[model samples]
Target: MPRRSLADLAPGDLVDDVFLVASKQSRADRQGNLYLTLDLRDPTGNISARVWNVTKSLADSFESGDFLKVRAKAQYAQGITQLVVSHLEAVDPARLGLDPAAFLPKAPVSIAVLTSQLRGFLKSLDDPHLKALCDAFLMDDAFLADFTAVPAGVREHHAYQGGLLEHVVAMMTLASTVGELYPEVNRDLLLVGCFLHDVGKVRELSHQRGFDYTDEGQLVGHLSLGVSMVEEKLPLVQRLLGEPFPPETLLRIKHMILSHHGTLEFGSPKLPMTPEAVALHHLDALDSKLHAALREIRDDPDTASRWTRYDPKRNRRLFKGSAPPAAGEGEEDLD
Candidate 1:
C-alpha cells in the first residue's frame, strides 16, 4: 500500500508512512515512566506524535532530521490533530531511494522567480551608496545561496524552503506601494530595510536537516547578527564607491534592522525611531501575521468548525470566512 500523507490524516485513521523527524523529546509521564514526543513531517505538513511507555534506548535511537518509518493511529486532541505512534524506526533515506526534498515543505513561489525579482528590486534603487551596500551582499555567492534557500521562520509564517526570499520580495512590493502613498517617506531606504531586515536569519538558522537555530543564533539572535553583517560590508561599499558611505544612511539602516521587532518586549533592542524604521517594523509584523493566520486557517483539519482551534501564540481562534468563489472558464483554480 502507498504511504498516507500527513496532511490528509483525519481522526480515527490509521497511518503507516515514512516521515522526517522534525524534533523529538523524551519526557517523564505522571508515574515517572519515559515517553517520547515528536514532530513528524512530510512535504504537506507536520503532526505532533506521542509514543507512550517508551524506553530511553528507543527514544535515543533516532535523532531529529532522520527519516523514520512510522506506525500510528491518527487522533485529534487539544484542538489539533496528532498521532499516537505504536512503533517507529529510523531509516536511511538514500538506501530506501527516498528523496529528501519530498519530505520538506517548500515555498509555493519558485526560487528562480523570486531571485529575479530581488535583483530587479536592487537595480531599481536610486541611491548609489545604498545600492552599492545591497550589491555587496548580493555579489557574495555563498551568502546569496543561503539567503535564497533559508526559511523565514521555524513555525510561524513562511516556514518553508525559499521562504526568506518570498517574504523579502513581498515586503518590497508593499514598500513600493506605501512609499507612493506617503510621499515624505524615503522609498529607497525603506526598500533596502525590507530586503535586509531578516537577512541575518540565513546565518541564524540551519536548514540542512529541518529548521533549527545554530549556536550563534541561540546566543546572539538575529538583530545583532544583522547589525554585524551590515558593519562588515561597510568597508567594501566604501571601496566600491571610492568614498565613505554616509554615516546617516548607515545608522538608519542598522537602526531599522535592530528595531524591526518594534518593541523591547518582542526582542527589539530599541523601538523604531525613524520614519523608515517605524514603517519597516509595522510592515514586517503585518506580513508575518497575515501569513501565519492564513496558514492556520488553511491547515485546520476541522472542516466542520467555522473557527480554527485556539492558538496560544496568537491568543485567539481565527474565523474561517466564506468559501472562495469557483473558478471561471479558462481561469486557474486557486484551491
Candidate 2:
C-alpha cells in the first residue's frame, strides 16, 4: 500500500507504508544502537524523519543511501513532524511493492516539452560567439540526456525528474525580464550564461535512484567542473569559428557561472563583478526560493485545514485553508 503522509497521520495508526528517501544513519547510546536523520521527500514537500530503536544487528544493516521503509507513529515536536519508528526495514528488492519512480520527486512539467523550449531559446541567441559556445556544449548527445533528466537540487525547488530543465527555463525567464532593465548586460550572452551556468551539475549529482554525489562530484563540485567544461569547448569554438571568442567575453561568462551566488560564503568563489553577473546571480536565487514557496503552497491545502507542521523550505508554518460555504447552502441543511 502507498504510505500516508505525516500530515495524514494520527496516533496509534499502523503506518505499514514505506517512505523511500535520502538518509543518514549513525550510532549512538550505550549499546551502540542507532538513530536515523532522514531527508523525507515526496512530491508534496520535504520533512525530517527519525527512526529510533536499534540494536547491533539493525544498526549494522542500516546505511545511508539505502532505502528504508519506516513503520512508525506520527508525533509533532517543536512545530515539526517526526516519525517514531516501530519497525524499520532496509527495503529489500525481493519484497518491496511500491513504485520506485513515484518516490523520487519531480517537476510537474514535461521533460520533452521543456527540453524543446530550451533548445528553441538556444537557437534564438544571435551573438556568434555566444551561440557557438552554447551550441558546442549543448550539442553533445550524452550531456543533453543527463541534463534533461537531472534534478536542479537534492531538495529545494526543481528537485525532480526534468527538474534541471525546469530550473534552467525558470532562470531564463527571470534573466529575460531583468536583462531588460540593465541595458549594458549583453542580452544573448546573459541568456547563454543563464542556461549554461548549471550544466556542470550533470556530473555533480548521481540521479539513478536517489540524488547523491559521485566521488568526482564531491571532490571537484559543480562550479569548478563547469569552468572546466567551458574550457574544453573553447578549443573547439576557436578551431571551427576562427578569431576565437574575445578573452574578455570568455572571462565574463565564466565569472557569471562562478560567481552567480554573489558571495564567497555561498559557495561562489568570487563576487558578481559585472552588471550581467549581478542580474544572473539574483535571478538564479529568485527562481530557487520562489519555487520552494510555490511547492509549500501546493502541499499546504492537500490535507484540508490540518497543520503541516513547519516547512524548513519556507521558514514558516503551512496549514490547510477552510473551504468557503457554497451559495445558498447551509451545513445543517445537509444533515
Candidate 3:
C-alpha cells in the first residue's frame, strides 16, 4: 500500500505508513494503566499518537529517531488532530527503501539563495573588526556547511534542514531596515549580532537521524556554545587582521549572543542591555514567534476549524481567520 502523509489525514481515516519517531513516552492514566505517547513525523509535519494498553517493554522497544510502521486511525479532539494507533512495529527504514532524509523537511527557500543573501549581508559590513569576524566564520568550510544545513530549532520555528540560514538571513533583513530607522543603532553591530545569535545551534543540534539536542547542547546550551564559538574565532580574526579585536566590541557581541533570549526566565542569563543587543533580541523574538504562529496556522490538521489547538507554551489559540472568497466569486462589477 502507498503511504499516507500526516498532513493529509483527517478524522476517521485509517493510517498505514512509516514515520520517524520524533519522541516517545510511557505514561499512565488515573487508573495506572501504562500507555505510549508518540510524536510521529514525516516530511510534511508531525502528529501526536497514542497506543493504549501498552507494556513497558513495548514502549521501551522503540526509541526516538527510529522509524515505525504504524497502523492507526486519525482522530480529532480539543482542536488537535492525532492518531489512535492500533498497531505499531519498529522497522528498518533502509530495507523498506526509505532514506531518513526523506522524512525531514527542507527550508522553503533554496540553500543557494540563502547562502548568497548571507554573504551579501556579511559583505555589507563596514566596521573593520566586524567584517573580519564575519569573514572568519565565512572562510570556515565545515562551519558553513553545518550552518547552512542545521535547523534553527528542533521543532520550533524554522525546524528543518537549511532553516538556520533562512532564519538568520530573514533576521538580518529586518535588522538592516530597522537600523535605517534608528540612526543611533549600530547597523554593523546589529547585523553581525543577528547573524551570530543562533550560530551555536549548529553544534547544539544533531539533525542526522532526527532533531535532538547534543550532549553539549543539553548541558551547556546554544547560548554558551555560541559564545565559545565566537571566542574560538577571535584569535583567527586577530591573526588575519594583524591586531587584537577591540575589547568593547567583543563585549557587546558576546552580550548580544548571551542575552538574545531577552530575560532571565527565558534562559538568558543576562538581559539585553545595549542598543544593538536590545534590537537583536526583539528582532530574533519577532521572527521566531511569527514563524511559529504562521506555521501553526499552515500546518494545523483541524482545517475545518478556524482556531488552532491551544498552545500551552504560547498560552493562546491562533485565529486562522476566515478563508478568502474564491477568485471570481467575490469580484464586484466596478462601473
Candidate 4:
C-alpha cells in the first residue's frame, strides 16, 4: 500500500495498513481523548496531524520519533490534515520494513564544505584567549568530530546535517562585517562568542541522521553544557601556556556564551550587559533570521505577498516580490 502523509489524508476517509510516523505529541483533550501529533513528510513537504486516542495507547506505545504501522481514519480541517488513530504498532525492521529517508530531514548542500569554512574562521582569529578556546576544539580530533558533525538547533535554520558549522560560519561572517560598523564592539570577542556560543550543540544534539536531543541536552541544557565545555577546555590550554588563563578575560568570554540569547525569556540567564554581548546577541539573531527568510523565500516565493509572523528570536517577517501599483495609469503618466 502507498504511504499516506498526514497532509494527503482527507476527512472521514478510511485508511488501512500503512506505516505511521510520529513527529510530535500533545496533552489529552478536555473530552478525555488523547492526541498524537505527527509531521508526515514526503519528497514534497511535511503536514501536521492530530490523532485521537487509540485502543492500544498509540501515543504511549510508540513515541514522538517512532515509526508505526497503523490503521487510521484520515481527515482535514482548518488547513490541517489528521489521522484518527484506529490501530498502531511500533515498527521494527524485523517486523515491518520502512525507508529511513521518510522519517528524517535532509540537508540541501554538502556539509563538508560548510565545515571547511568553520575551520577557516578558527585559523583567522588573532587574540590569544579567543584563539586558545577555538583552537582547542577545532583542532581536537574528538571534539571536531562532534562539533562539525552535528546540527545547530533542534527546529530552526541550519537544523540538519553539518548545521552547527554552517550556523557558526554564517554568524562569524555577520559578526565580522557588523563589528566594523561599531568600533566599540571588540571583533575578537565577538568572533569567539560566535564560535563557542553553539559549541555545546555538539554535545546537545545527537549526530545520528535523525538529529535528536542527547541525554545531556535534556538534563543540563546547552547553555550550561557550553559553560562546562569552556571549563573543560581551560585546563588543556592552560597546560600548554605554562600558566592559567587570566580570570576576567576568561569570565567575559564565558559571559558572552551564557548571555548571547539576550534575555531570560529567551533562555539566556542574563541580558547582554556589554557591547560585545549585545553585538553577539543581535548578530546571532540576525544570521538565523536572515537564513530563515532566505530559506522560506527559496521554498515558496508566493509567501512574499503575505506578511509572515515575526520570528520571536530573529524578529522579522519574510516577503518576496514587490507589490504591483494599485489601479495605476500606463507607464509615462507625468505628475
Best by lDDT: 3
lDDT by residue for model 4 (250-282), tens: 888778889988889989999888888898888
Residue-wise C-alpha lDDT for candidate 2, range 27-116, written one tens digit per residue: 476876566666665534445667676666776775545567666666666554566777777775337555655667776788888888
Let me know the TM-score candidate 1 reaches against the reference structure: 0.92
Q: For each candidate, how many residue pairs have backbone atoms clashing (under 3 Å)?
A: 0, 2, 0, 3
What TM-score, computed on C-alpha atoms, does each candidate reach? 0.92, 0.81, 0.93, 0.77
Over 4 Å off, model 4: 1-22, 27-30, 41-45, 70-76, 80-87, 93-102, 207-212, 293-335
Clashing pairs in 3: none
For model 2, give the 10-residue run with minimal summed lDDT. 300-309
Q: Compared to the true structure, candidate 3 yields what TM-score?
A: 0.93
For this target, which candidate reaches the highest TM-score against the unseen true structure? 3
Q: How do all the candidates rank in terms of lDDT, highest first?
A: 3, 1, 2, 4
Per-residue alpha-carbon lDDT of model 3 for 62-170, expressed as tens digits?
Answer: 8988999999998887667899999999999999888998788789999999999999998998899999999999999999999999999988999999999999999
Model 4 worst lDDT run, 10 consecutive residues: 300-309
Cα lDDT of model 1 by residue, 1-335, tens digit: 56666677789998887889988889998899999899999766789999999988898898888899999999989767899999999998899888887777899989999999999998999999999999999999999999999999987899989999999999999999989999889999999999999988988998878888899999999899999999999899999999999999999999999999999999999999999999999999899989988998998877778889888877899999766666675687789
lDDT of 2: 0.75
